[model samples]
Every structure is written in C-alpha cells, then in structure tokens.
Target: MKLTLIAAASTAFMFSLSAYSQDMPGMKMDGMEGMKMEQETKQAPVADAEGTIKAMDTSKHTVTISHGAVPAVQWPPMTMAFSVTEDQLAGLKVGDHVSFSFRVKDGKAAIVSIKK
Candidate 1:
C-alpha cells in the first residue's frame, strides 16, 4: 500500500540526515557546542593601564606598549601589540608616555581610549 511505502521512505531519510550531520566538520550532535561558543565570545571588562609606546605601525593601525603593572587585571609589566584607531595614531610616536584603557579578548589586546 502507499502508506507502507511512505513510512519506509521517512525512516530512511531520517537515517541519512543523521549520518550527514555526523560526517560534517564542526557539526554538533549534542547542544553543548553553543555553550562553548558563547563563553569564547565573552570578554573581560575594560581595565585602566599606563605605559610607554615601544613601537608604532601606522600602516597596520597597531601599537606596541611597554606597559607597567595593571592592578585591575593583575597583569605585570610587559610589551605587547594593541589594535588602535587612526585618531589614536595621530601625533603619537615610539617612546611616548601614555595613559590608556584597554580590554583583552581571545588573547589579543586593543586600546579603547588614550588620555592626553
């Protein structure tokens, strides 16, 4: 009967879909992947910091700062690159002292603001 044929076809389709999902890259069978992705996207709060500009790359829009200890984030003095805006780069040069605010996400840092 048509009803019997239809039921068999539906079962086969479900099996094929399950197999396809398992074979795909980054496809999740469980729902925990969503939770992991959410955690990765969440970033720490912005912290106040101060340091000297060790290097600057106007073309890359990045600056390397040899910053002092950041008590708010418990970070020790170190030189690291930070993404910056064109306005932030204006008149700025290496070895210049700067007081700035920054946030770290996915192990990269960026300058949020710079104080004159």
Candidate 2:
C-alpha cells in the first residue's frame, strides 16, 4: 500500500511538471521576442492629506509629518517622513498645520504640493 501511494505521488508530480513545461502557442505571437507590450502598472492615484509638520531636514529635503487617516490608500493615521523639494520647504516650519497632495509608489511617498 505504501509503495502504491509513493508511485501515485511521483506520477502526479511528473504530470504537473509536464503540464507546466508545455509551451502555449499564443505566448509568442509571430515569433516577436523582447517586443512585448509594456505591462500596466498599478500606480496609485494622488491622495490629498492633512497633517502637521513634526520635523524637517534641509540636507535630506524631507519632512516628518503626522497625518490623519488616509482613505485613498486605506492607511491608518501615522507619522511618516515624506520627500520634498528644497523650494517646497520654503515658508514651512515645524508645528504648522498644512494640506498637501502626494502619491505613493514602491512603498515610498512624496509630497507633490503643500501649503499651510
């Protein structure tokens, strides 16, 4: 009985491997290699956020903001540092309330526009 079970398992494994090894005809249309269409990216839409500036680093051109809940990305209220241009940092200070728009990609967020 044990030998039969092992044979059955090995047979199943070989069948699965063969199924995957078989190439689909549609995968290579007209034999065009390396000319595949650009895969669509799931870029998140820009989200408006409200937060208070908790800290800033001119050298890094970034600000630490404690923001409210963000529904656009389903993120809970949290404090995170966001990258911004030096020009955008002008006229901004710590402890000031502000509104901003930002986009997140690859687990990183950048402030697109900000104003107090």
Model 1, total clashes: 0
TM-score of candidate 1 on Cα atoms, chains taken together: 0.61
Residue 67 alpha-carbon offset, candidate 1, angstroms:
0.8
Question: Which residue pairs clash in candidate 2?
Answer: none
lDDT of 1: 0.86
lDDT of 1 by residue, 62-90 (tens): 99998899988888999989999989888
Residue 25 local lDDT, model 1: 75
lDDT at residue 48 of model 1 (Cα atoms): 86
What TM-score, computed on C-alpha atoms, does each candidate reach?
A: 0.61, 0.65
Q: In model 2, which runs have C-alpha deviations exceeding 4 angstroms? A: 1-43
